[model samples]
Target: MQGLKAVLPLLIFVFCVRAKKMRWCTVSDPEHKKCAELAKALVAVLPPAAVAAFARLSCIRASSTTDCIEKIRANRADIVTLDAGEIYSAVKQFGLVVVAKEIYSDGGCILSVAVVRNSSVDIRSLQGHRSCHSGARWTAGWSLPLGFLLSRNYLSWSKEQLLSQDVSTFFSGSCIPGAAAMAPALCTLCQGQKSYIRQKNYHCETSHSEPFYNSQGALRCLRSGTGDVAFVDHLALESIEGSDRDQFRLLCTDGTQAPISHYRTCNLGRGPGAGMVTRANFRKTARKFLTTAQTLFGPRGRERQRFQLFNSSSFGENDLLFKDVTDKLFVLPDDMDVSQVLGLDYVALLKGLGHEGSSLEDSVVRWCCISYAEQKKCEQWALSIKSDPLVCVRAVSMRECIEKIKRDEVDAVSLDATHTFIAGRCGLVPVVTEYYEKERKCVPAEGSTHLETDVLPSVVAVAVAKRSSRSIFIGNLGGRRSCHGHMYSPAGWLLPYRHTLSLEHNSSSPCDPDQVYNSVFWKGCLPGSQGNLCKVCMGGTGEAATKRCADNHNERYYGNMGALRCLVGDPSGKSFGDVAFLEQHNLQANILSLSSTGWADGWTASEFELLCGDGRRAPLSEWESCNLGIVPPNTVMTRPVLTARVYDFLMKSQETLAANPNTEFKLFESQQYGESDLLFKDATQCFVHTSHMTARSILGGEFYSHIESVFNCTHSDILEFCNQDICSIFE
Candidate 1:
C-alpha cells in the first residue's frame, strides 16, 4: 500500500496533463473544418518552446454563436470569435471576457452601410422594396439599419408585435438568414442548398449551406437581381473585386447616394469588429495561442504558402474562423472589458436597438405619480399627448417615487425643492424646472437685463392664518394646532419651524425633527405622522376613509391644497387646525377653487393673512416680503442616464400641448380633476431645461443653506439608505 501511494500523485499529474486541451468553438460545419485545419497548421509550424506553453489544440462545433457562448460558459469550449453584438451578449449575459479584437486596415471598427445597384430608389421610401441582409440579428445587416430607420421615423413598429414581423411587412421580400421561423417572408429570396444531397434541406440557415447567408452572399443576392438592396458593412464592399463592385452605390440617410467607398459619409453607424473571447482567468492562455497563430499565418507570415488565418476561400466559405478582412489580431488591455471594447456610442446603439432587453420601456417616458388623483391626471395627460408616448407609474409617496427612479422601475417624477434635494442625493438629476414666469427662461441670458417680472422661477414658503385667529402669530404659536402638507415638507414642515426648533444649534438631543414637531404642537394634522401629530387629520371620503393620516392624497390633509383645507376649519365643522404652512404659488388659486368645488363653502383669498417670522401680520399678497424663504420650484427628476431623453420627451409634449389649445388635457393645470396641483403645480405655465443645473445650483446659495439647516440636524431613512456604498455606484 505504501508503494502504491507514492505513485498516486504521479498518476494524478499524468491525468491532468492529458486533460489539458484548448478547444476552439465553431458555429458552422465549414467553420469547424477550417478551425481543424488551422489547429493542424499551428502544431506543424510552432517551435518546441512556444508549443510547450499552450495546450493541444482541438475544435468543437456549436449550432450558433449563442450556443458557442453557452458552451464556453459551461467549460465545454475554451475560446471563440464573435461579432460586436454577440460579444455584448457573451460578456453581459454569460460573463465571458474579450481577449483580442480584429483590427482592419481602416480601424478596429466596421461601418454599416446600404448598397444598391443604382441610385434610382430613395432610401427613405423603401416600403415595398426587396431587401437582403447578411444575417438576422447581425450588427450591420439588421440592428444598425433597422434602428436607424426606426429612429428616423422611416418605419413604424409597436411593442405588441415582434420587430421581425414589422420588418417582413415593411419589405416586399427579403433574404434574412436565421429568420426562417420568426418571419418566413424574410427568407423568400434565400436560395438553399439544392445540389448537395446531404444538406439539401438547409433553408434560411445562418451557415454557409444557405447560398445567401452572410455579407458576401447578400452581395451576390443583390447582384443576381434577387434583392433590390443589400445591407452590409464596409468590409464587404472592400472585399468584392471586379468592375461589378462599381455598379453598387451607397445609400445615405439624406436621400442621396455616393460611391461604395464613401461609407464614412453614407453609412448607418459604426460598431466594433469581431473579437476573440474566453474566460477571464484563461485570457493569458488564449492570448498566447492567438499570438502564435497570428505570427504563423498572418498577412506578413512566412507560413502563408501552407495556411492563411484570415482567408476562408480555400474552405468554400467566407469568414469561417475569423473575419476575412481582419488585417491583424490586436491584444486588448488586461483591464479592458466588453463595454470598453465596444465603446460608449456603440454600446448605447445596441441598447437603443433593444439588445439590452428593455426596448419598450426605453421608448417611452414613464412619469411617476404619488397619489390616486395625480395618477388620474397623469393618465389624462398621457392620452392627450401624441408626439412622445407618456406612461404613468404610481408610488405611495414622493420618497418612494425617488427610490423607484433609482431602481429603474420608473423614469421621472416632478419633485418639490426639498424632495428634489433628497432625490439628487439618491443619484436622480433634474431634467427640467417647472417654469412659472411668463417671459424668460430659468437661467437669464448673458447680456440681457433682468426684467421686472423675473423672479428666478421659485415658490415662496408662507405661514398663513385665518384673520379671525387674532392671538396666533408666528412667535407666540407654541400650543396652537398647525396644518402641515406632510412630514419633511419644505414649506409645511421645514420652513415653518426652521426658527423655532433651531435644530442646527442643538447637538445633545440628536436633533430629531419629528420629536421637535411632536413637542411643539399641541395637536395637528400633519400627514404621514402618527400619534398626536395626526390627531386633527381628516381621512379620505367614501371608500377611501380607511387611509386616514396616510402620506398620499388619500389623506385629506396631505399637500399644499390639503393644508389650506385644514386651516379653513374642515368642511366637517372640525375646528382643530389654526395656522397653515405651504407654498404661496398656488395659494390664491386653490382658495378661489375651494368655493366652486364645495370643499370649503365660503373660503376666500381675503379671509387668510400671512404671518411674518418677526411676529408681524400682513396681507396674503405680501408673501414676496413676509415669506419664510424662497424655495426652488418643483423640477422633473430622473436617472442621470435618462436626463436627456426625459427632457426631450417633456419639451416635445409641451410643444404639442401649446400648439393645440383645444386639447382636452393640460400639462400644467390639474384643477380639472377636483383637486389642486395633482402632478404639477397649477400655477406653472411652461418648462425650462435645467441644462447641467443640479438641485443645489438651482436652489441658489441662500435656500440651500436653509435646507442644510433643516436636514443637518437629523438623519432620515432616505439619507441612511442612500448614503450606503451601493448608492455610490449610481452617483
Candidate 2:
C-alpha cells in the first residue's frame, strides 16, 4: 500500500498532462459541425498512447473570422484557420503567430491567375472590360492581380488617390464582391442573392448572398459570360464541372494565352495560402494538436469513413473548417513570423495598397527632421523643390525618426552610418546616398553609375587635436579630456570610440563603450551624454545655458563643427578639450570660417593636427592617410515600398534645384540654418540614387564588417532591440 502511494502522485500528474484540451475556433455553423464531428471521430480511432501526443479536440463557435481572432487573443480558444489577408491582421494587429499553413498539392502557396473564355485578349488590354474577382482585398482575387497591374505600370495609381478608384476605372464593369460601397460599378455583373437581386445590401456582400463572392463563385461568373475575365486561384478552375472547363483559358503577363493546366507559368504572383494562427505562447500546443489531427482524419486516416479533416461535403458546405483543396497542414518553423510567411515583397504590396496604412504619398515626400533648425531647413528646402512636393516632419531624435518612417508617419530621412545600420536592421532600405566627389549634372551615362557598381563616396574619419596638445597620442590618451560630435554620430562617437576601445584597457566594464569612454576621459564634451561626458559642453551662450548636454543643435558641442569648437577651448578660456574626433569633409572650411565668423579670435587651418593610428601626429591636410577609417556617406532611407518613389523625387530635386549653382536654394547647403549639416551634409556634392543597393551593400563589405564587430560588443539598447527583432523574424 505504501509503494502504491509513492507512485500514485506521479501517475495522476501524467494522466492530467495527457488530458489537455484544444479549443478550435470556428467561424460558421458548418465549420462548427464539421469540427465537432472530427473531434468525436478522433477519440474513437486513436489509441490512448497515440492520443497522449495531442490535446482532446473541442469546438468554439464564433460569428466571423474577426470574432475568432478576438476569441483566440483572449485565450478563450486555442487555434483558428484564417485567410492570408486575415492572417496579416491577426499577426500584425492582434499579436497572433502563425503555427502552420494549409498547403495544396502544388505547395504552401496558391497561384493567382486570370481566366478568360476568349483567347484573343492580351493581358495589357484587360482595361475597359468587365472583370470578375474572388473578393475585395483577397490575396488571389484582388490584391495579387491589382498589385501585379500597379507594379508593372499596366494601371496607374497615385498614393494620394484610392486604389479602388483606379481599379474601378481599370475595369469598365466588374463583379468585385464586398466593394460596392467603395466602387459600386465593380459589382455590376455580380449576381446578388440569386432570388433577391434588388436588395442592394446583398448585392455585393462577401457572403453567400452575393453569387460571385469567392473563387468558385468567381469562376461561375466567367462561365456564365457575365464577365470577360476572372482573377482567382488556379485551384478554382478545377471546380469547373466537366465540359465547361474547356471554355476557360489563363492570361499571361507576357501578352499570351495558355491553357488552364499551364497556370504555373501563366499566373499572377504566388502568395501564401490560408494559415493557422494562435497566440505566440500557445504555438507549441497548436502545432501538436494540428499534427495529431492531421494524422487521424487526414487523407490516409484510420477513421476516414467517419470524418475528413480537409473536406466538409458532409456538412452541406465547401471549405468548412479548412480549405477543401488543402492536401496537408504544413507546420512552419517557430522562427517564421507573419511577414516571413507572407514574404516581404507581398507585405510591401499590401502596404502599398493601403491595407494597414498608406506608406507612400504621390503628392509629397514627408522629410523627417531631427531638430528645430533641421526642421526649418527642411521646410525651406520643401519650398524650393518644384517636382514631387516636399513636406517636413519633425521627430525628437534619430531613432524616433527611424521609428516614424517604419510606422509610415514620415516618408524618408537622411541617416548616418551608425543609425543607418539600425534602420537596415529595422527593415528600411537606402534610397539615395550622399555623393562627395564633385558636382555633376544628373545625366545618363554609358557605363554603370558609381552607386550601381558599388563605388561608394566615403568621408575620412580623423582624430583632430590642437597643435598644442602634444602629449595626446592615439595610444596613450587615458585621463585626458575628449570631444565628440554627439553620442551616436559615426565620426564623433561610434568610429573613434570603438577604435579607442580596440586598444588595451583594464576597465571592469568592457562591454559598454559609453561607460568605458566616460571612465577613460577625465572630463569631455560629448553632446547627448550625461555627467562627466557633458562636463566640457558649452550650452547656448545667453539664456540657453540650461540646454547643456542636449542631443541637438541647441548644444554648442554637438556636431563636427562643435567638436572643433571644443578643441579650440571655451570663450572664457577656462576648459579646453584634448582631442576632437570629427570627419574631414568640411574640416578646412569650418576651420577657416571660425575666424571669419568671429567664433574664434585667431583660428587657422594650421592650428589643428590629425592623430594617426601609428602613434604619430600629422597635419590636418594629411587626413587621407592619418584618419581612423573611411566612413560611408549619409544615406536617404525609407520603407522598402517607398524606395523607388523617394529616389525619384530626390533625383528630381537634385537636377532642378541643386544641380544648378544659379538656384538660390541649395539642397546640400545648411550653413544659413546656423548648423553645419541640417537636412544633408553641406559637403555633399551630389545625390547617388541607390535603387539596387541595401544599407549593408552601400556600407560595403569592409565597413559593414567593421561596424558589425563594434555593434556586436557595444551596449546600445535601440540597436540591440532592433537587431533582436530582426533576428527573431529573419534569422
Candidate 3:
C-alpha cells in the first residue's frame, strides 16, 4: 500500500504538468512553446499567496457579465471582462468602473450588411429594400448605417423620401442570424466581425460601409455571398483580396478617403458617456467606490482606455445618444414638435428638468429638438435637461393642477391664493408667488410662470348624498343654517328646566343636556328630519330623556310660541282653585305641558330675563309680563282656567292684532325715572315701543320689516346668551 501511494503521487504530478501544457497551447502560439514555458516559469516565481489572490480577484471565470457584476458587488472579485457594447449600459445602469483592456486584442467599431452576391443591386438600387438590425428601432445599428449612407449621398434621397419609398425595417435580437433565418429573405445590418463569424456557413455579401471601421476580413467573406449588396466594416475592406471581394466595391466613405468612395466627413464629436448610476441614497457610496477604483487604475493607463469619469457629464451623454438614435430612425412623426412631444414649455430647458408619461412619439420629437440643438449649439449643453415636451402641455383641471403641484408632478404651477392655501393645508409646499395684473390674479410660485386664467373656480361645498337626511334637512331649512341664534334660545329655555328638573329628580342634570336637546329639536323640525331623529333618541332612556324634555320646551317656546301659550290656558270647567292645585303639584292635567317635562320644569321669568340681559339687569322688553306670570320657587304650575267665551275673545284679538298693519310688539324698555335706579325690560316692552313709534309715523307700512328685524335681533340675542356658557357646557 505504501509503494502504491508513492506511485500515485508521481502520476498525479505528471497529469498536472500535461494539463498545464495544454492550457498554455490554447492561449499561446504553438511555435512559441519555449516562450510559453518561460512565461509559465515567471508566473510560478511569484508568491504562492499572490497567485491565489490573483485567481480569486479575476472575473474571467464568471459565467456571464451579470455574474461578474454580482461577484464584484459581493466583494468576491475585482477584475471583470465585458464586451465593448456592454460597457456603456453597465456604467449607466450599475455605476460599474472599467479597469483594464485585454492585451493584444485590437477592438474597434464595425458595420455589417447582409446581401446576395453576384447581383446588380448597388447601394443606390437597393434603397427600398427591407433592413434589420440587432437593437430596438431607436439605436446605433439602425441610425449609424443610415447616417453614413445619407452623408455620403449614396442614394441621393432625403430621410422623408427614403421613408416614403416603403423601406421596411425591423430590430431583432440577432441581426445576422435573424436575416439569414428571415421568412421572406430580408437583409440585415449588424457588427461586421460578429455577423461574419456567426453567418460563416451562409453565402452572404457585404460592402465597406462608411462612418465606421473594422479590421477583420468581414468585407471579403460578405462579398462572396449570394446577395448583391451588403453592409461591411471599412477596416475589413483593407484585407480583402479574393474574386468575391472584387465583385463588391466601396459605396461611400465618411471623408476618410478609401478607393471609389465619396462620402462627406462625419463629425464624431466627443460627448459625455452613459452615467454611472446607483440608488439615489447610495450615490455617496458609489462615488467612493469609483474614486477608489480611479486611484488604483488611473495612472496605470486604465483611466484613458477603460473609463471616462465625469461627475455631471454622465447623464447628458446618454440623453444625446438617445436623441441621435431617435432622430435618425424617424420613430416619431415629423409634424410633432418638442413642446407637443415632451408636453412641457420651453422654460423647462432653462430649468433643466423633464416631464413624465411621455410616449415614443413624444420621444422622437424631443430627439429632433436635441439634434437641432446639438448641431446649432456645438453640443455644449447637457442633454439630461432635454426631454419630450408633449407631456408638459396637457390641460388639467384646477383641482388636478393643484394636486399635481403638491405631489411634485410638475416642478411648479401658477395658482391662486386659495389653491396655495389648500395645498399648504394639505402639507404641500409652495415655492413661488406670482401676480398677473392684466388678469387681476395672483399666483404663488418661485420661478417661471404659466397663468391659466381661463380656468374656472372649483366648486366648494360640503357634499352629502341626495338620500342623506343632512342633505334633505339643509334643503328644507333655507339651505343656509346659522350657528349662533338657533343654539341659544333653546338653551335659554332649558337652563331653568334643568335647575327645576335637578331639584325634582334629586340628581345633577347631565352636562349640556339643554344644548343637546336644542340641537335635536331644531334638526328634527326640518323636512325629512325623521331619518336623523334616532341619533338623539337612541340614548334618551337615561340622561338623553332629560335632554329631550329641554328640547321640547325650546321648540314650543321658539318655533310655536302661540301653541305653547294656548297649552298653558285653562278650560271653562276648571276653577281658579283647580288651576292653582295643578300648578302646586306640577301636574300636566289642567295645563298643557309646553315642555315634555311639565310645569315643574317650565322656563322661568327670571331665567329668561337673565338670558336676555348682560347678566346684570333684568331684560327690558318682556320682563314685566314674564315676572307677573312666574310661579313662586318650587311651586308646580298647571294650565290656567278660562271660559270658552274668553278663549274665543283672546284668539280673535290675537288674529286682529296680527292682521293690523300698524300692530307691533315691544321687546324691551328702559327706566326713565331715577339716575341711580337703572331698570331693564324684555322683548314685550321693546316690541311695544317700536310698534307705537311706527303707528305714530306712517302706520303699518314698516310693520313686516320691523317684525323681521326684531325676530332677527331676538335670535341674535339668544345666541349671545348661550355663548356665555357654551364653553362651560363642553367642559
Candidate 4:
C-alpha cells in the first residue's frame, strides 16, 4: 500500500476518468516504423455516426508488444493490436481485455502454414532439413506449430538448454530473428556475411542487407534455395502466389503435402488472428472503439479512404497495425472471451511450448491464499489429496489474490460469502459451493419472494437451551445468560439479534439493539470482548489473555461450534449459557463425538438440546419448528470470465476431494483441529453439488442487506461508544 505513494496522485486521477477520446497504442518497431502513419489513418477513417461518443483517437507509441501491454495496464494508453500469442501474454501478464478481432479479407481467420519447394522429395523427416521461420514465438512460426508438437509430446527439450537447441535439433539450420540472441544454430545457413561481424551480430537478420526475416523473408529464403522449408503463415504464401506459385509446397502435420494455396484444408492450425485489446476495466470503452473502427472499415462500411482499416502494407510491414490478411474489424460474440478466442486446445498448446519445467503443469491446481499460515496447512492438505495436488500462492490480501487470478498467477480460492461478492464484482463467478446436505429455507436476498425447493432446506439461525430446562422460551428470554459466536457472523450475532429486537418486549420502541443486549443478558460470553463481557469469556491465562480473541484461537469461544462449547463450558465443568445463539447445524453435529482433531472439549451432545416455540424442546434434527432464520451456504467463486481450464480444474477438485471414503482428506473439515474452522467448516460432511449461484442469492437478500446496514453504521451510533463502555459487549 505504501508503495503506491511513489506514483503521482494526479496521474491516478487522470487514469480513472471514462473519457470520450481514447489513447490508441501502436507498436513502434524501428524496422517497420509506419505505426505512426497507420494510427493517423485509423483515426481519420472512423465512421461519422461514432463521432459524438468517440470523436477522436490519441495515438501512443510503444517500442514493442511487451511495452504496449505495459502501457495499457498503467492507463497511459487505452488500446493496442496483438497476435494470439501476444494476446495470451497481454491478458495473462498485463490484465489486458479483448474487445474485437481482425477478420481476414477472405472472411476466414489467419492460418499458420509450413512451406517447402514443390520438387523436394517426399520429406518424411524434418531432422537435418534446413528451415526458415517467420520469427521466434510469433503465432505462425513458433506458437502454433511448435505448440502443437510440444503439447502432444513429439519433441523433448531440457530446461537447462535454450529453446533454440530444440529448434536446432529439429531443423539443421534456420533464419529466425527472434532466435538471434538465444539460438545461434538457427542463423547458421544465412547467406549474408557483413564486414562488421561484431556490429551485425545476427548476420541473417531481416534488414534489406540480410536475405531473410519475417514471414515474407522466410518464404523468400525457401524460394531462393537458402532453406529446404519455411515455417510461415497463409499471407506469406499468398505474397508469391501469382508468379512463383509452383515454387512451394505446404507441409501438413500428418506426413502429407499440399500446394501453397491449400492452407484452408492443409495447415498447422488456426493462427491467433490479430486482436485489439484494452485494460480489463475498459470493456465498455473497447467495445465502442472496436464497433466504431469496424463501422468505418468493415466489409459493410463505405470505403471512403484509400488506405483500408486492416491494411498492414500501408505501414510497410505486411502485418503491422493489423494483419495484412485482415479485411474486416470483426466483433467477437459476447460469450467468446480472449481465452476462448485463442481456443482451448491451443491454450494448452501454448502453455506446453512455454513450460520451463520438463513435466506438464496440466495436472496441478494452483490455489490462492492470503497468508503463510493458510499456505502451510494447504501444503499438508495437498499431500493428502495426491491425485490432483494443490500448489499454493500467497498474496497480501483477498484483493491481491483475485488480482493475481486475473493475471493467471493463481487458480482458485475458497471465499467467504461477502468476499465472494467482491470476487464476483471483480468478474469472477461461483464455480462450486460448500453444500451441507441439510435442507435449509431462505427468503429472497433482495427485492423478491423466496425460491421454491423440496428436499434441501436453508440453514436456520436458532436460540438453544437445554432440552431438560422447563422455563426458557423466545418470548421471556431477557436477562438470561447468553452465549454467542464472533461478531458480525450471520447466525451467532446478526440473525438472532435481529429476531430479539423484533420481539414484542415490555420496553420502549428500540431503534438500537446494542443498548438492549447488554441490559438484557445477565452475563454473556461473546468472544473477542473486554471488561465485563470478558468476565464470562474463558480465555486461558498468560500471553493468550492479552490478545483479543476476535478471530480463531485467541478467543476461547468463536464459531458456531465454539458458542456451543461455551454453553457446555470447558474442562472445569462450569456451565455458562442459558441460551446459545448459532447456526441450526450445531444441534445436529454431534458435539459428543470425537472429531479428526480429537474429543470435543470434554462435552457430550446429550448434555445440551434445542429450545423451541412455547417453551418446548425438540431433538436436534427437528429444527424446522424451533429456528430463528435460515440462509444459503458458503460458495467457491472465480472470475465471471472463466476459461475452461479454471472451470474444469475447480469442478475436478470438487469431485476428487469429496469422493474419499475414509475421510482422510476432507475438503469441508477443519484444517486446524483445536481452533476455529480454518480451510473449511468443521460442521460440513461433504459438499453436495449445486448450480452456480450469485453471492446475493447465496447470502439471502434480506440478510445480506442487513449486514450491509449494520456495517455502514458509524461507531458513534453504538451505545457503548456513547457511554465509553466498550463496543465488544454488544455481540
Candidate 5:
C-alpha cells in the first residue's frame, strides 16, 4: 500500500486527463555534470500522489534557455524557469505568463552591490580605478546599477548606451565582453585580442577563460587585484572565503560603507528573482503543475533526494534558466498578471537595455483635467492604481488640455467625440470609446420587455425655443441671444456654428458666422467660450475662467441640461435666451425636473418647440426634422506618441473602477458633486475598445469635412474660430 501510495503521485501527470499530463522543458547541456542528474532526480523525488487530481509532469530537454522559450511557444513544452530580464522577453515576444517565483531562504529579491577591498576606495571618489562587472546589459551587472547612476545624472550616456556600451569612462580600465561592439573606452583593460572580436581565449570574452565576465568571474578579477571594485549580485559574497569577509566592504547608495547583510539599503537595486514561464492562457494549469511539483520534489518536500524545482545549481552555469540562490518556489498572486508583477519601471529599464516592451517606456502616465471634479476623481484614481501611478495635471479648459497634449505637457484626457476631432487635429489619438447605456425598450426570449445588455443609442443634437418666440427665424438668427453648452460641443456650439455659416446672409452682416454670432447674441452663455458669452455661466472662476463654463451641473447653463436652464428664463425678466442649443438626451433627463429655476416653472408640453431650418418652429416631438446632425459617443484621447501608456492607463483604471462600483468615489460619474458626468459622461458604463479604429476614423473624416463645407457656404471663419482640425497639425 505504501508503494502504491508513493507511485500514485509519481504518475499524477501521467494519469490525469484520463488524468491528463503536461510537459515542462528544462534547458540542459549534456556536458554539464549536474544537468542530467538534476532533471532525473527531480522526477524521481516526486511523491506519487501529489498531483493526481489535476496534472501530471514530464520533462523535455532543450539545448539552451532561448531554445526552451521557443519550445514553450511551439506548445511542445509548457513551462520553464527564467530570470527577470528573460521574463520580460518571454512576455513581450512570446506572450508567456509567470506562474511562480524563486524565494531565497533570506528573502525573495537578491541585492546588487558594489564590492571593494577595505580602505581601498570610496564610491564617490573611484574616478579612475579599474572596475569589473558581471556582464553588459544584465540586470545586476548593468541595467539596475547603471540606470540608477544615469537617473541621478552621474554619468554621460549616449542614446543606446546601456544596451550597446560597456561602462562609464570613470573606470580607467574594465572587462566587459559585449563592449566589443560598443564603447571602446570601456574595454581599455580587457585581455581580448586587439580590444575587439570574439576569438577563442579573447581577453574580455564571456567564456569561463575570461578573467572577468560574470558574477564569479568579476569577483575573481577583484581577488586577483585586476579591478579595484566588483559590481556583482549578493549571491557572490557567500562563495567568498569566510575569513576574507573582513577585507571587503559594500558601498551604499548613500555613499557609506556597510557589511553584506545590510545590503537591503546598500545595494544598487534588487535583482527580481527568476520565475516559471508558460503561455498566459495556460497559466491556470501551469500554476497547478508547479505548485504540485514543488510540493513533492522541492527543497522542503518529503522526498529523500529533495530535488529543488527552481535550483540555479541544476544548470551548473551560475545563471541559466534560474539562479542558484533559490531555496523554494513562491506562487505569484492569482490576480497579479505578468505585466503588473514585472512592473513598468523595470520594463522601461529593460527597454533601455534592449529587452522587450521597448515600444512603451515604463513610466507613470500623466492625465490632464480641466475641472475640479475631474481633478478630484483623478486623485482618487491615482490612489487606486497602486501598481502604476496616474498623475493629474490641470488645464484651464478642454482646448487648453488638448493644447497641453500637443505640447507634450500632459499625456491624456477624455473628450466627447466632437472634441475628439479637435484633439485629433492637434495630433491626439483615440484610445477607447466611452459607451453610455441608453434606456431602450426591448423584449427578450421570454417576451418580457427588457433593456439590452449593452446598448448606447445615438444622441440627437437639437435647437430648443419657447413657443412664444415669433420673430427669431433661422436665417435672421444673427442678432438673437444664444445659449450653447460649450464652444466646440457638437450639440451646443459646433453644429449651430456650422449650420449658421452654411447660409448666405446679408452681405452687410458679418460674413464670419463666428464673429457674427459674437456680435449677434446680445446675451450668451457659451460655457467654454470667452467674454460676454460667459455672462450667465455658473462655475468657480480664476485661471479656470473657461472651465467655469464647463458642461456639467456646475455651470449654471452648461451641457444639454445647462442649455435648457438658459432657455428656462426668469418669468419677470426677458427669457434667458431666445434659443438654446443642446442634446436630446439632456432634454430627456430634465423634462419633469424643474426645481431650481422659475423660467420653465409652468412650461407645459405645448409650450416647448424645436427651432427649424426655414425660420419656422416645429412640435417638440419632431426634433429630428429640425435638429443638427448626430455625433459619436465621447472618447478617451491621447497623442500618437503616447497611445500605449494612455491605453493601458484608461483600460486599467476603467477595470479597477468597474470592479469596485459600490465605493463612495467612482471614475465615471460624480454622485457627490450631483453632476451627471464631469470628465466623462455620467451615462457611461464601460469603455469599449475598437480593435483597429482610430480618432480620424471616428471623428475627423466625415464630421470635419461636413463642417468645412458648411462654414464655406457662409464665407464664415467659424472653422478658424473653433480651430476645426481638418488636416493633420503636423502637415
Candidate 6:
C-alpha cells in the first residue's frame, strides 16, 4: 500500500509536467517567436488580474495565415486575431472561418497631412502638389486620405498631368498592422512620452511602438525636405513632436470637420484594423469562448471594475469589437432564389437607408416579397387608409407648384419631404412618420381614415401663408410689405369722388377725384367750396384722407411699404446655399426677383440674405428651408414605394440644380396632346405588370441574369425554374 501511494505521486507529477509543456508547445512556433515575445511583453504590462486571466487562457501565435492553419490542424490553438484586410485575404486563400470581428469606428485608419505651419500650402491648394504617403496598406494613415483627394479630384494619378505640375508622391511604411496597435499608439501619442515612462504605461508604449517609430521617422524625413508633404497617422506625429513640433503642422485630418480635412471618405478592402477568426475545426468552440469572454469583459464587466487597465475612459466601452460582434450574424444565401424566398434584400435595404448602392436590388426584391411582407403590408394598408387623400395634385407648373404654395394655395401637400422642405417654408408638414417601436406608440391607419402614428412624429412642421386680413395687416405692419400689398386691399373706396366738378371763376375747373373723396369721407363737413363739388369737398385734403382710411391701414401699408426696398436689395449676401433662398421669401420672391432682375440687372443669385430688423442680416435660405422641411426627397431614399430609378431621378434633380451656374432651372409642365389619360394608364399598366411577380421571383430572374453575365452555366438553371414558381405564388 505504501509503495502504491509513492508511485501515484510520481505519476501525478509527470502528468502536470506534460500539461505545462503541451500548453507552451501549443503557442510557441519559430515563425511566431516574435509575436510570442510581443505577447509576453504585453502580459508584463497588464494588471495583475488581467495577466492572470491571460495566462489561464490559451495563446495563439502565428506569423502568416498558413502557419496559423498548420498549428490549428495540429490542435495547437483555437482563436486567431488578424487585420480585417489580411483576414479577407487569408479566408479567400485558405477558406478559414471568421468567427469574430473588431471593426474600427472611422474606417480603421488615422490619416493626417503634415505640412509646415504657415506654409503657402493650403491643404486643399495642395492639389497636384508633391505628396508622400506611407503606402496604401496603412488605410487610416494614407489610403483613405488619398482616396478622398482622388474622389474630389484634388489628386491625380496620371503621370502626364503630374509632370511639372506640382505633383509628387511617395510611400513610407508607417503605422501598425491592426487597430489594437493603433489604440495604444493613439493613447501614447496624445499623452506624450512622459506619461509612458512608468512601468504601468509600458504596455501602451509597446503596443503603439511600431506606429511611434514610423510616425517619428516620417515626420523627421518630411521636416528634412525629403518630401513636400507627409501623410501619416496621429501616432507618427506624436512620436516626433519634441524634435519637429514647431516645424510641422497637421494640414488635414480624417474624422474632423476642420478646414483642412472638411470631408473625409472611406472604402473597402484596405487599412489597419483588427478582426476575429477561428480555427476551422474549432469554430464552434471559439465562438462560444468569444461569446463568454465578451460577457465577462464587456461594458458591464468593465463598469464593475474599480480601475480598468484597458478602458480607463468610456470610449472603448462601445468599441466596435464588443458591440458589433456581439450582435447577430446574418449569412446571405448562395442561391438567389433562396435568399429571395427568405426575404433577404440585405444590400438594397442598406442602400435605402442611405448607404451607397451596390447590387442590392435582387436582395431587396426577395426581402420585399418574403421577409418583409408583413411590414410592407402594414405600410400599404396605412397609406391606403390615409385621411388626407393621395391624389395626382399639381399646381400651374413645377415652378408654380413651388411658387403657388409659397403664395398659400392650401394648408400643405404631401410630396418628397426633401423636395417640399427644400423648396417650402420652414414649417411645412411631413405626411409619413418614422420611429423605433420600443421608444414610442404606433397607431395603425384604419380604412379610408388617416390615423396619426405616434411611433414616428413628423420632424418637419406644416406652415400656411397668413390668411386673415388682421394677420396679414399685422404681418405687413411687421415689415412684410410685399406680402401685405400683394394679397390685401378694399375695393370701391374711391368711386364716389370720380367726377367731382370744381367751379373756379378764373380757370376751367379741374376735378380731383382722390382729393374730393378724401375730403367728404375723412374731413368733417366744414362746407367751403363752389358749385356741386363744394358739398363733396367738405374739409381739407390731409385731414380728410387721414380719417377716411382704416385705423391700422396706414400703419400696415407704410410698415410693409418700407420693407420693399430692403427686399429688393441683393439677396445673395449670406452665402447660405440654394434651399435657403427658396424657403424664406417663398417662390414669389424669387420669381419677382427673376422678373425684376431680368428687367434691371439681368441675373439673380439662387441663395441670398436680406437685411432684417437688426443690422445683422438673416440668411434668406429658401432652398435650404424648403429642402429641410420636405418629405418625399428626405424620405424617398428610405421608402419602398419609390423604386430605385425614381429615387435616383429625384437625387439627380437636386444635383442638377446644385451644378447649374445660375442655380435656377426652368421646369416646363405640359399635357400630352390628345392623350391626357395616357400617363396614368401607362403607370397603372406598369404597376400591374410588376405586381404580378413576387419579390422573390423578380430577384431570381435578376440574379440569373447577373450570373449569366458572369459565368456560363451548363447545369439546369435553378433560378429560372424558381422564378416561375415565385411568380405564380405571388400572383
lDDT string for model 3 (1-731, tens) is: 35434433433343333221111111112212322332343234323432332222111233233444455555444433232233433443455553322111122122333323434444544454433332211112223344334322333332232221222342121223222322223333344333344223222122112101111222322443322333432322333455545444444222221232211122211011111222223333333333333332233312323332211123321111111111111112224332222222111221111112122422221111101111222122112123222123212222344334322333323222222323333323322122112334233235622222232221111111111122222112222211111122221221222222211233232344333333423322211123322122211232112222122212221112212222232122111110000011111121233333332244342222211111122331333322211211110000011011112222233344445545332101111110000111111111111100111121122422332333343333222331332112111
Native-to-model Cα distance after best TM-score fit, residue 469 in candidate 2, in Å: 1.4
TM-score of each: 0.56, 0.66, 0.25, 0.45, 0.45, 0.31
lDDT of 5 by residue, 1-731 (tens): 47536756545654354444566675434213344444456456444443343324566765445567888999888887765666777877887778877777666555679898856577766668888887665557666777655433344344333434435566788776445445766665555344233233345544434456567778877888888888888877887767788778898766789876677778877646557888766777777666655665566655535555445554445554445566777777567755455543355456545565223333667788766656777788788765457788987667777766665567677887656776755545666676665453222336522212333345667888877887666666665678887766778766775465224444344423456567666668887666778765666444334445564434657666667767875345443787888877556446444443333565664777887765677887887777777766788776443454465566677667667778666776554543345777766666665313556666646776765454465432222433432111111
Predicted candidate 4 versus true structure: per-residue lDDT over 241-340, tens digit per residue:
5757876788876668888778888877664566788876776767765664554454454432644555655444565556666666655555565545
In candidate 5, stretches whose alpha carbon ends up further than 4 angstroms from where it belongs are 1-15, 18-33, 42-79, 125-128, 160-163, 166-214, 279-289, 304-321, 332-336, 352-731
| Model 3 regions lying over 4 Å from their true place | 1-49, 55-85, 93-143, 146-174, 177-221, 226-228, 241-247, 253-731
lDDT of 1 by residue, 229-285 (tens): 999878988677788778889899888999887889899866677788898877876
Q: Write the per-residue lDDT of candidate 2 for residues 579-669, one digit (tens) a residue.
A: 9988899989888766666677888888889999888899987887898888888988887656666867887787678456686777777
Best by lDDT: 1
RMSD (Å) per prediction: 12.1, 9.1, 32.2, 16.5, 22.5, 26.2
Candidate 5 Cα deviation (angstroms), residue 43? 4.8
Candidate 6 ranges with C-alpha deviation above 4 Å: 1-34, 37-122, 125-137, 156-227, 253-731
Worst 10 residues of 2 by lDDT: 722-731
Scanning candidate 1 in windows of ten residues, the lowest lDDT window is: 722-731
Q: Give the RMSD in angstroms, all C-alphas superposed, for model 4.
A: 16.5
Steric clashes per prediction: 0, 0, 65, 20, 16, 47
